[model samples]
Target: MAEHKIYTMSVAKVYPHYVTKAEKKGRTKAEVDEIIRWLTGYSQEGLEAQLEEQKDFETFFAEAPRLNPSRSLIKGVICGVRVEDIEEPIMQEIRYLDKLIDELAKGKAMEKILRK
Candidate 1:
């Protein structure tokens, strides 16, 4: 199968949507950044660098310093598919981020959304 277009799309292109989704629901960009940091283990500076470099989702994930193991615990339907049911590793990771953003928009507690 051809690689999903999202794999090639720059994370920088999609990142603003994540921030807007959270902000529209009254959450701060900091919260979205926190979730990304929690999921990918990128320090604030490192995260900024990733954004600055406009890395594609594939490379963004591939270069993640330490993808949180607890990400497997993130279970829910996102875009009509359960995140845990995604067979492709990269797609699953992408959906994991999407699901976290959705939770934040829905007003889930930060700790719970972080799976603490």
Candidate 2:
């Protein structure tokens, strides 16, 4: 089967949208960054490096220092698909991030969004 197009897309390409979504909803970029760090285990500096490098989603995820084990706790529909039901691991990871961002945009408390 052909690889999903999203796998090759740069995470940098989408990061701004996530930030904007949150910002429009009265959330801050730091909150978006925190959610990303919590899910991908990338430090603020490391996350910035990945963004600067324009790494594709596959590479971004592949090189993550430690994908949060608690990411599995993220479950919900994003763009019409339930994240937990996604069969592709990379896709699931992508959706997990999307779900978290969605929650942040929806004004969920940071503690709950981080699953703490």
Candidate 3:
């Protein structure tokens, strides 16, 4: 059987796209920053450094100071796959971010989106 490799996507590439999606729905860069920091435990400075470095998603998540425990509570379908049902831990974490972005774009309150 031929082995297949998963192509890792770049967080730096998608980060601005996410911000644009959120801003179009009346969100702000600050709010997107808040979400990223809340989930990844990165300070504003650290987050900015990562963005400036243009890191890949794997590296970005790998370097996160800490992943929020409450992130597991995030439940929903993204791209036809349920976030909670994702088998790969890393992929699940990525989907959690996607779900949060979806909520932010849909105008869910920041408090709720942050799972506070």
Estimate the overall C-alpha local distance difference test score of candidate 2: 0.94
What would you estimate as the lDDT of candidate 1?
Answer: 0.97
TM-score of the candidate numbered 3?
A: 0.92
**Model 2 clash tally, residue pairs:** 0
Distance from true position, residue 59, model 3, in Å?
1.0
* lDDT tens digits, residue span 1-116, model 2: 89999999999999999999999999999999999998888999999999999999999999999999988888889999989999999999999999999999998999999889
TM-score ranking from best to worst? 1, 2, 3
Model 2 lDDT at residue 81: 94
Worst 10 residues of 2 by lDDT: 69-78
| Among all candidates shown, the one with the greatest lDDT | 1
lDDT of 3 by residue, 26-83 (tens): 9998999999999999999999998888877777888999999999889999989999
lDDT of 1 at 41: 96
How much lDDT does each candidate structure score?
0.97, 0.94, 0.87
Clashing pairs in 1: none
Look at candidate 1 and tell me the lDDT of residue 106: 98
- Estimate the TM-score of every prediction: 0.99, 0.98, 0.92
